[model samples]
Target: MIDLLLEMFSYMFLVRAVVVGLLVSLCAALLGVSLVLKRYSMMGDGLSHVGFGTLAIATAMNAAPLTVSIPIVVAAAFLLLRISENSKIKGDAAIALISTSSLAIGVVVISLTTGMNTDVCNYLFGSILAMSKSDVNLSIALAAVVLALFLLFYNKIFAVTFDENFAKATGVKTGLYNMIIAFLTAITIVLGMRMMGSLLISSLTIFPALTSMRVCKKFKTVTVCSAFVSVICFFIGVVISYVYATPTGASVVIVNIVAFLLFWATNLTIGRIKK
Candidate 1:
């Protein structure tokens, strides 16, 4: 395993992929706990679709994908939050409406200009080779910002995630904290989309939190466990991807599925033992 990992790291592209992917995994894991608790886990999926639309437009315009996509997707996140909070659309329906619209727009733009090429395939399905040195550097910087923000606002986010009404009663700006969560999630989704794909980026923000919940009851324990699960699964997935020549994103999701099942099984066993 060490030899294989060393061999994988010998390639600059692999090194970049691992570094950026790990950081994104950490960020996703942290933010995911809140989203999962709040039942807003699919926010990542919706924002990713919006990201795809913005990326397609960027590609057609010969502009930088991340630069163009970030603001648009962030705005979409804010819109999603507002619609879910105020409009009759509400929650899953609001997510579906925006996500489907963005996805359709992305497809139309791709058909008109890029015409489903290699770059488009990479954006849709993710490719390890897609991480240029510059892309890795930018992703690292952005991922750092995400980690810092999440850590700094941990208490406020925790309060809002668990009980928005209570938090508001306690004088916490629940709306502001919720928007911050959405903002962080948007950035995390975009940072991961290059390596995880727009279609699968959300799994990073979802599976770990759910897997941890299978065993850990407390929010803090679940959060910590989610981080560990995410990082370990990502590493194992990368190894599997290198050995089997599988798609990185799909491999990671499979690993996460296995992890979730194992945690679930373990929890069941403990329950039966107590019974």
Candidate 2:
């Protein structure tokens, strides 16, 4: 165990991996809080597919995937928000349509691209082993931006999440706030794609929030606990992946699932005993 720790610390790639995991987890936790509260838990999944589609197109054009994907997904997020507000299409239905379309487009684009091994499986499932130093730095910057935005809009977001009608009554510009949340969700999905992949990235945004809400009674407590749990789960997943020679993203997600289930079970048992 000591040897593994020392080795992980010694390697630059391992350090990058750990840092990327931490930053992505923090971003997911922050966004997860609002997502869960708003009952938009599937938003992450939809944005991730949009990110994947952008990545595929970038790969075909021999451009930087992150550069291409971020802006596209952000724009798509705003469009979705507008559609949600102006049309009768339900939020989940909109998300489902977008996600399915993006995934289909991504798969088709990848197939048409020549000389690119389009590792759809890795992108779908996740591949922490593929993380680079640049990716880590980008993750850190993206996470910082998301955190800053969340802090700036914390009160409005709290109001909107709990009661949109009340927020609108209080002159909170609920539509604009919802749009901002969607924009941030898109960015978070793009940033997290490398660590969690398009398919499983939503887990990072959902599990920690779910676990924290199960145990914490207060909103502030839930936010803090979710972030803490997210960090711990990411680290554990990375370490376990290194030790077991498994895919880092899948391993971390599995760890998150296990942790969530354990906490949920404990919460349920305690509640029953209290009764």
Candidate 3:
């Protein structure tokens, strides 16, 4: 076991993969709590598609995919927030529309430009094995920014999540907070795309939060537990992928699902025993 671990840790790529995975997991766990509470669980899905579309466009234009994706994702996030304020189009509908459109655009653009390659598969399914030092640094920077934002607006975020009207009545600028949440979501989705893929990125935002909520009642407890769970799953998944020569993103997502199931089952059993 010790030899195997040392072997896994010896490679620079593996080390980078681990760092990126941890950063993505931490940021996703933090943002996911509010997403679930606000019933915006699908927001990750939307932003991921937005990221994918931007990536495709960037590829076609010979630009860096990350650079292209970030601005577009942020803009889409802001637009979503604005649309939500209208109250005419429900949040779910808006998300669905935007998400589907963005994904379709991505698919069409890729078809017209690159004609598909292994890179497309990697992007769609995740490519932790392909992680570089630069990717790790980018993930770290994004996570740091997300953490700083959360710390700065913790109270206002708490209020918005629990009681938006109360926050608005108290002049908390709920609209701005809503936009900030969306922007953060976009950033998380973009960074997460490489680790989790456009297809499974939502799991990073959903499963951890769901599993933590099952076992913890307090909001802070949920965040702490979820982040812990996310990191565990990420590391375990990377190890499994390395050992089995499997797709890292899929492996990580599977680990997260297993954890979610275990938590959910345990909750059910305890509830039955209580009864």
Candidate 4:
């Protein structure tokens, strides 16, 4: 396995994918804990869907995909947050509204112009080859910013996640922190959509956090465990995808699903033992 990994990493594209994927996985895992607890886990999905729409439009216009997609998706993220916070459309309903609309637009645009070619398929379903050198560089920079900000604001994020109203009462800026979370999540979704695709990117956020929560009660513990689980599963999934010629996004999601079930079973067994 070590030898295989070394050989795989010898390729520049694979290295780019691994480097960006791992960073995106870490960012997604870290933010996912709070998002899941806040019932905003679907934000990743919504942003990725928005990303696809923008990417499709970019493709049609012969423009840079990331340049076109990033700002649009970030705007969509902020829009989703405001709608959830202010309007009658709240939580999953808000997410679903943005998600379905974006996905439909993307599908129509792609069908009209690109017509579901290999590159478009890569964006929709993820391919290791999806990350170009420029994409990797951009992804790395954005992912680092996401990680650094998350660490810097960890305490505030924790407060907002557990009790937003109480955090607000306690003089914490709950709304700002929530927007920060959404902004970071939107970036991660776009970065990861290269390797995990629009359809499967959210799994990188949702699975590891949920899996860790099954056994780890503390937020810090769950965050650390989720990071580990996400990176390991991504590595395994990449190896499997390479060897079996499977879709990178689907393979990663499958590995995450297996990990979640195992953690759930372990939690149940521990509960039984305690009883």
Tell me the lDDT of model 2 at 59.
Answer: 76
Per-candidate TM-score against the hidden true structure: 0.98, 0.95, 0.95, 0.97
For TM-score, candidate 1 versus 2, the one ahead is 1
Tell me which residue pairs clash in candidate 4: none
Among all windows of 10 consecutive residues in model 2, the one with the lowest summed lDDT is 113-122
Residue-level lDDT of model 2, residues 1-275, one tens digit each, is: 88879988898888887887787788789879999888889888888988888878887898877889899999988877777668899888998999999999988999887433647777787776656667667778888888899889987888899999988997889998998898888888888786677888888889999998888998888988999999999999989988898888788889998989989998999999999
**Residue 8 lDDT (model 2):** 81
Q: What is residue 52's positional error in candidate 1, in angstroms?
A: 0.8
How good is model 3 by TM-score? 0.95
Off by over 4 Å in 3: none
Q: Is candidate 1 or candidate 4 better by lDDT?
A: 1
Residue 239 shift from truth in candidate 3, angstroms: 1.1
Using TM-score as the yardstick, the better of models 1 and 4 is: 1
List the candidate numbers ranked by lDDT, top first: 1, 4, 3, 2
Residue-wise C-alpha lDDT for candidate 4, range 1-275, written one tens digit per residue: 88988888889998889899899999999999988988888888989999989988998999988888888999999999999889987668988988899889988999999687787788889888888888888889999999999999999999999999999998998889988999999888988986899989999999999999999989899999999999999989989998898998999999999999999999999999999
- Over 123-187, each residue of candidate 3 has an lDDT whose tens digit, in order, gives 78888765556666877898899979987987777899999998899888998898888888889
Model 2 ranges with Cα > 4 A deviation = 115-118
- For residues 107-139, write the lDDT of model 1, one tens digit per residue: 899999969788778888888887888888899
lDDT of 2: 0.85
